[model samples]
Target chain A: MRSVSQKATPDASRRSETARRAILTAALDLVGRVGYAKLTIEGIATAAGVGKQTIYRWWPSKGSILFDAFLSLTTDQQDGALPDTGDLAADLKLVLRATVDELQDPGFDLPMRALHTEIVHDPVLAADYATRLDEPMRELKRDRLRAAQRAGQMSEDVDLDVAVDLLFGPILNRWVQRTGPLTHEYVDLVVDTALRGLKP
Target chain B: MRSVSQKATPDASRRSETARRAILTAALDLVGRVGYAKLTIEGIATAAGVGKQTIYRWWPSKGSILFDAFLSLTTDQQDGALPDTGDLAADLKLVLRATVDELQDPGFDLPMRALHTEIVHDPVLAADYATRLDEPMRELKRDRLRAAQRAGQMSEDVDLDVAVDLLFGPILNRWVQRTGPLTHEYVDLVVDTALRGLKP
Candidate 1:
């Protein structure tokens, strides 16, 4: 709790904000270590060096804590925001390149993969995973594809939804299956090759 | 072990075949009930009415036993066949549709999902899973894509490797991520859209 006297000073509020960040970081580190099934409020509090009551006061569940912790780490505050450089191909390439880097990180991949495994059987987790992660993932691609279309780089009838799904579907699939080397070259090739129809 | 005399007889071999099927079926059922981590050779032997030594003699590891059991269930024992309809689209569609059916089945999905999750972190398991499963998978897609190219359905300069990857990447992505509803309609859309370039 912020001291009433400290709250009166802007500097103490900033210090409190730093404490909140440390707590979130600690929660994320703990989730990465123990995984979803074992992640508990007390464990998070201990990791965060905050009271269990503090976490409960802010969030309802362990899943929420981990999800929010992860969300903050990505630094992507808005789901719909993608770069609008007016060059659609370059923009898509830029976003995908960032995704490639994000996916390659152990911090993001390990916990996300753990979360994904549970989501397979748990509908509540599945719905949240879809809404919070999967759909936003789709929207990321959809926005890029829409941008491409608006720039006249992609066909008008390409069906932005389907286009996004198809484009992302393969990339997502490759990542999930670990089927191939997911490098910048691979993403660029898939994007380019898909643009040029298979039939000449 | 087969006796020298019984080994010479077709009927005795038939009986051995029957027991092997029984063991494999039991293995599948048991693995479904208790996950791979909990599954045991003794349990498989008991369920199949075979001696523990019989399973041990036949399979060196539980992973091998479960692997064989799963392979038996998913495979139809076709004679090294890749679909060869003269029409490339039809041929590829037929193959993909069959895969869609296989992937959609709970019998296949459960154990496959379980094994898939396990292999994500274990490099040895990942290699084993890839060799045992992905080789045939790669072969099936490669053959189909090549057939299309040879038939002039695909671009002449189309990179066979990339095309093959594209054909199944989206489906595999959906399957692993549980991101989207994978259906024949979706498959058709993927195949069609992928075949025709996205450009206007």
Candidate 2:
């Protein structure tokens, strides 16, 4: 029950952040090497050289620990913003190209994939991941497309929800299913096809 | 080395088929329960009520067993197919509506999700899965769209790949990510949006 007010005592605050970071790093490392099921709080604590209570005080479960770890790894654990450089197509292309880069990074593959697999199997983890990770990305994508629409780039009647999916879904399908090589060319293909209406 | 000879009796052929079905079923049940990593050849043997020698004499690894299981599951799995009753939008709607039904079916979810997530991390498994499952579904969708294209119902310039993704991507995005409710209404939204192409 010790909230931020109690933690704001400088000594507590400093120790908490340090332990939190250590715990996250350990969790990420463990999942990367051994996968999600094997990565436990005790294992993470031993690997992090922190007490198990330290991790439990912050996170309730191993899945929770992983949720934080993925968040921090992706964007410093904040509600990260997507790029908004003013051109709808350019901005979309840029964001997707960066996403392709992230997916391709060797350091990210294992743990991210582990998290993905876990989400598929465990409903609790899937719900938590969706609420915390997936929805934000979706909203971010939607907001960007809405911005484009307001700027007169997209059609007024464009279904924002499906449009967001059209932009990002193929990339996701590729990543989750490993259906194809996720090259820059592939990302461009998605962006181009999504935009300009994919019709003659 | 055990290629069936013309002189070989029907009994041997029936036995081989029976073994094949047992291995496939065992793989599905085991992978569904324990996961891909822990699913060993010995484990499959025990689960299938066969000897380890019987398994090794046939398939090579757990991956191949699961691969065969998934193939059979997909082929006999369910009836979520694109309807070709001649109306493109209606056909698409019917197909997607069935997919929504499948995603909602508790029996269909866990195993399919299990295999999907497992393959995300396993390259060999992923490649085999893509070949067996993802590729075929994609091609089916593409062929449907192509037929629509020829019938003057769809845009010829629309990349069938992109169009298919647009058609099914949101539904899948919801299913895989668990972002939102995947209802008949949601399917209708995507079907309408994708067909319209957002051009004023």
Candidate 3:
């Protein structure tokens, strides 16, 4: 929430950072407890112990607040890169299994599902999600695939976009639809099966 | 509304059939117009010109009503079987392309998104969806894959459930997350890539 002004001293910036973290943390906690449909700015403000004006100054809506909260959580785990151990299958399996673990964690599950519920019906939020979360995460995955291509592990003509989907889609769809169990073995199979078609 | 008793007669069955159709049709229309969140039994009753008791008697809740309405729509199109033309690629492409068309259709899109939105947050509704809709659809798709396996078009070691997810998951994920455009070309690539890994 720090602005580009000379008046933003180190003390002020630290205060701003503390408040920002509080607000985002509160947003996630409140959403998890009350659910997204019932989440409100007033509730978030009350939970965060901050004025509604502070939240308003930063995020325009509850969706945006939740988005930032989820994004912050992801950023903490990933460094915006998939592992490239020169073994595509092993690397992908490692990353996806971590994802499986995170999804299964109760703390992460509620807020994440809440964000998805908001994103599904709201186009503006969905677009924001794509630009901010989905695309960047996809790009990191694509970077790994591109490395595979360069290593001659994958074909030149393969569409990385489609490949990313084939690799990640099943896990995602299963999680969202509750169509199957999310387990390390499932992701391992996904990686192995998808790699066959992706490889040169 | 017909009970299995001596009082149940041909005239009563005919009237029940007409009312059932009206209720299902009205549920879809009202959800499309006002969305699932704002939709109510009272509104559906008013729209269908039936008593609220009639809808309550037939379906336990709004979610159940929507489920039946959607099932009715899908039943009108697919006969619980994916076309088995022996050419696995051709058969899947044909079915997936029709799905692409349906998802793009506004009438189908709205109610479908609504059902998904409801399913994400509500475990009870999600369970009903999996039992009543998702499982039946997946079974039909699996049957086609099984046929491919028997014909030696796909490997015997291939897990049909994983294969089904690989083929359909990408498109479903893209649609649900709004991560990418749904197109014949996209599904074609998905089928091709997934088939490479699947084929013996």
- Candidate 3 residues lying further than 4 Å off, grouped into runs, are A1-8, B1-12
What are the clashing pairs of model 3?
none
Residues A88-127, model 3: lDDT tens digits: 9999999999998998887888887887887777788789
Ranking by DockQ: 3, 2, 1
lDDT of 1 by residue, A3-108 (tens): 8766677986786677668777777677667767777888878877878887787789888876777677655533457778776656667767677777778877
lDDT of 1 by residue, B101-174 (tens): 88888777776766766665555776777677776767766776666677777777766656776777777766
- TM-score of every prediction relative to native: 0.88, 0.81, 0.91
Q: For model 2, what is the C-alpha lDDT against the true structure?
A: 0.77
Q: Between 1 and 3, whose TM-score is larger?
A: 3
lDDT minimum window of 10 residues, candidate 2 chain B: B73-82
What stretches of model 2 exceed 4 Å from their correct place? A1-16, A77-79, A156-159, A197-200, B1-30, B38-62, B76-82, B198-200
**TM-score, B chain alone, candidates in order:** 0.85, 0.82, 0.91
Answer with 1 or 2, whichever has the higher lDDT. Answer: 2
Q: Which numbered prediction scores highest in TM-score against the true structure?
A: 3
The model with the greater DockQ, 1 or 2, is: 2
DockQ of 3: 0.72
DockQ values per model: 0.48, 0.49, 0.72
**All models, RMSD in angstroms:** 3.4, 4.9, 3.7
* Residue B152 C-alpha lDDT in model 1: 71
